[model samples]
Target: MENNQEGILLTSAEQSYLWTTYQADTMAVCVFNHFLQHIKDNEIKSLIVFALQLSEEHANFIREIFIKEKIQIPQGFTESDVNLHAERLFSDVFYLNYIKNMAKGGLVTYGRVLQNVYRKDILSFFSACLSQSIELNSRAIDISLKKGLAIRPPTIPYLEKLEFVHKQSFILEGLGRREALTGTEVTNLFANIQTNYIGTSLATAFSQVCKTKKAQNFFKRGKEIALKHIEVFSSYLKMSSLPVPGTYEQMVTQSKDAPYSDKLMMFHFSLMIYSGVGNYGLSTAETQRSDLVADYTRLNAEILKYSEDGANIMIAEKWLEQPPLAANRRDLAKG
Candidate 1:
């Protein structure tokens, strides 16, 4: 246990938060640099500039803490991980959506991390992160709306009257017997579909630009999985005669230049996979429908498998960075 002047040690939760946050911020810095290289839209460029500044600040803050604590700072994504000369791979609209989507993840992450952190400075850092993420999301959404690019979640009919379900069948789904989707289920389905839409396009672009055969195959498989999940999610909406979110594959350009290194792209995919799993877990926990729960569970398993394979690839390439670990008493005994 490390003791500072305050006599408090950094707990597992705090360390984990800081370690993972450092990685994510560094990756963001790399991608933002690439975006800045080719972004022509002044407004979108402004958002990128703000996002890059935040990520750089976060990485530097973590670096100082690690230095003071005598911990090894993570070699997160760097200049070598991005190619500024590569052609633009995505549209201006995607840059906005990417920022908005990533900001949502930041809000979720910072909020969760904030709850588990208690040190005054750590607490303040995460609180600021939450505020910044919210502002980022707000800014991106405002710009998206201005450009008519915001794909707002679908709205269901207003409740005419409150009602209660008296039968267990309300939780069950089957041929000719499934009840209409509830508001929560509708929201989850719509949000997941849109996320898959983004994933589908990302996978496609990665497939086109990934450097190696193994990575290309992995990304192609990811695109297939994302498309299948989108179909599965959209089916539930169709069953109830509701609208589904549209795909964004056209948002990707025809450029095959590898804007990001294979290591960076693989890490980015892992982050997306983890986020998707968390989303599915939340959706499963919140939904009352048995069928939806089963599908979320099954699909999450497939994604986990894909994520594991991605991990193996990263490990093989020496691109996977280990996190801070607790002391091993057995190893200490050997020493």
Candidate 2:
């Protein structure tokens, strides 16, 4: 063993975290390689090929770190274990959708990891990963649009800045009383918390599986966003003296069973994103009456971006739920 004490600098917690992340990245590369062979779309296939190379490289680097640290690395899922040829039996549309969904999960994970790490080397590693993730996601988004696979969310016109008169009479009257939360408000809060948990868990898993330093760093940043959301929700629960929900854990893959198909995974995540946006909107509306309106509004805006990205992936996969459009409105008017 190379002098174990000379260059190994990560703390035990950091080492363990890196090891777990590396294992996940190993699995991700295997899956992407499988995707590369199975996908027929030349553009998507090219993108996956590039992504796979990046993932494999990162995996090797993490393995090197483990070797230097005298740590035993876990053997995560790999292409050898999965039936890529068998998966190819499925439609090309399904395959593309699957990769896109997995990418969204990865985006979330990189975001979180970036938030938790403080070391210069670790931070640099995550930053690079984040950049790659953005590039990959951008490519996916473009493909989805060109292929007519993207879904668009409802958008309202942006209003120019306008000043409103301040009113303090109501604030003065209710200054001493603690406001009660309505049932609808409580329900929305619970839903938003659940959505954040799911999003974060998926993101963390993606980061763990993606192999490039750029991608891993991106995953770290995603992890941070999820953690922050968790804190925000937990604080609210605490103020109400409610118990915090358990941390969301990734579903374990069975030794015998194939992991979730990519299409299904993307569809499931897209739903979560949509639900999160709706819940946030409701929460923001309710908070309008509270002193925390500014805080909730900021959070809502951040989550909205996440939700929009999720919707875009769904569109790329052609898995979005049905919604009324202008044509439908015109038909209804004619009727």
Candidate 3:
């Protein structure tokens, strides 16, 4: 047997976490492959293909590790599990948002894995995955901006000069307190900016895919909520002198005959909500200042509600994962 010291031995909790991540990665690969078949944009397709390959590789790696440790691998979703036809029924806009949201979730997952891992090899692997995820997200963001699938936020000019002068009782400030945003505040603003973009993209995609008056109305309301948040975040970015993210200029669609299915659209939206929650959690933890904390906390709560709504939609659509629930306390006690 390989030495436990040489190969990392995960605790039960760690195993559970790894299992969750593995399942998410597997789902991502399946979603990307479906997107690959329908996507016509070469750059976006290439990025999605690359991301799929990475996710597959990571899944294999985890499986190998679990095998080596004599631990049962979690029964996660596989290529055989996903309904490709159902996914393909969605519009290309929905696919783009799906992939982007998955990539965002990957960023958070890898970051958490990096923090939890202690073994050198495991840490290095997670770190590499984290970097790759970030790159993928950046590329997706770029594609979304170019295709006008995302909305851009405002930005402030970079400081080119700084001067400090002090008198007996007076001081000169280059920018007013209201005009400059602190670094910590800027980070929170950026987090919210990304969240808004994801939310809007999902709403727009859902509206197009569902093609029903009620569904479209639901999506329109979602878009309005995201727009309000975008404005709030943009104000912060403008005050801080930071660049805003790109905005959507045109709607994305696949062939009229192959409009996205409602199930696929809702699944993608659910994924985005989970990603947004993860990002908000990270931002809340990362920001230490009181004002920034308050902002992130409020944002986090709003996202929680959005996530709940998405979950309800998924349940109505029967697209959510059905994990086994414990029967009763007596059953558990007997075990």
Candidate closest to the true structure, highest lDDT:
1
Query: Tens-digit lDDT track for model 3 on 40-149?
Result: 77877778788888889878877876787786776666656444564344455655665675676777677666666766555666777788888888888888888877
User: Which stretches of model 3 miss by more than 4 angstroms?
Assistant: 1-9, 64-105, 119-125, 134-177, 210-221, 238-246, 254-267, 281-295, 312-335
lDDT of 2 by residue, 1-335 (tens): 22234564776445655665575566667667656655767977877787787678668767776687676665554555455554332344544454555566567667767777765666666677778778877887788789986543223235579956365523332554345444445445554555566566655554444334443454455557767877876676567655555544434111222333443344444445554555566577765335445556777687667656656654665544333122458778887
- Which candidate gets the maximum TM-score versus the true structure? 1
lDDT tens digits, residue span 144-261, model 1: 8998988887788888999887776777655235568888999999989988888888889988998888888998899899999999999999988888888888989999999999
Q: Give candidate 1's whole-model lDDT.
A: 0.88
Cand. 3 TM to true fold: 0.66
> For model 2, what is the error of residue 308's alpha carbon versus the real structure, in angstroms, after optimal superposition?
29
Q: Each model's C-alpha lDDT?
A: 0.88, 0.58, 0.64
Model 2: lDDT of residue 93? 50
On lDDT, the stronger of 2 and 3 is 3
TM-score of each: 0.95, 0.49, 0.66
Candidate 1 Cα misplacement greater than 4 A, ranges = 1-6, 174-176
lDDT of 2: 0.58
